[model samples]
Target: PHYYSLLAAYLECQKVGAPPEVSARLAAMTQELEARQRTALGGLGAATEPELDQFMEAYHEMLVKFREELTRPLQEAMEFMRRVSRSSARSPSRADRCAISFPLA
Candidate 1:
């Protein structure tokens, strides 16, 4: 799930014309994270219940860290894109102008 989100963010970076190195670095990090997850899951066989609980707790911590690390670059890229868009003279597309319609309570 996080891997897919990273890929989507990388694609968005490309769509917004972020630097080549930025996208490349993000792709590399995503691959590394996925590899780590695969390795961790593969090592879980034959563990006792208490050990499994500890492993899960540690895995959860790792996921939180991974999410924080992955989001920072994407957030920076998005903010940069927003700044550029705001400064440009070109009008936004119709899709950009459209607002979400919420159902009344």
Candidate 2:
């Protein structure tokens, strides 16, 4: 269950901050995720219980953590976009616009 454990640890890292051992743990987790993916979707597909549960839990947990982390970045980006839109509507030159333009024709 080293792989499974590594995945949990990776989730913890992303939630807080990548731990000192995250480098090594992530490497292991990557391999494990790959193996599980292959097994689940391989040509000779066979439903696995324990392995599937572990991998699915890791995957779901990772995604949830990722989404949580992205909340701030996404909000910031949206705010930036709104600012840019307002700026562009107010003034073209100071709107963070690029001078380069190409004609489709």
Candidate 3:
């Protein structure tokens, strides 16, 4: 779910013309998070109760770091899109300014 969410946001960032470096970094981070999840899940079957508890603790910590790493780029992309939308709204295109004829009701 997290991966998909991030992927969607990354794609949106690209669509909204966020910086290439920012999008690339985000894509890399998303892939890294997915890899970590896969690795963690793969080791679960071999863990004893105590080890499982330790793994959970470490996994939680990793998630916290992952969230921190992912948040910055997403925020930057959102801010960029906000600015873009604001500017676009402020400056209408020539077509946008043209009057549309409507039939009288």
Candidate 2: regions farther than 4 A off: 1-42, 47-52, 91-105
Q: Candidate 3, 13: how far from true, in Å?
A: 17
The all-Cα superposition gives candidate 1 an RMSD in Å to the true structure of 15.3
**How would the candidate models be sorted by TM-score, starting from the highest?**
1, 3, 2
What TM-score against the true fold does each predicted structure earn? 0.39, 0.31, 0.36
- Worst ten in a row by lDDT for model 2: 1-10
Model 2 residue 6 CA deviation (Å) reads 13
Determine which window of 10 residues in candidate 3 has minimal summed lDDT.
1-10
Query: What does each candidate score in C-alpha RMSD?
Result: 15.3, 12.5, 11.7
**Candidate 2, 57-94: lDDT as tens digits:** 77767765675785668678889999989987888674
Q: What would the per-residue lDDT of candidate 1 be over residues 1-79, giving only the tens digit for each residue?
A: 2333444444444433446788677667767777776776677654457765666666656655665676688789989
lDDT of 2 at 75: 75
Enumerate residue pairs that collide in model 2: none
Judge candidate 2 at residue 59 and give its lDDT.
73
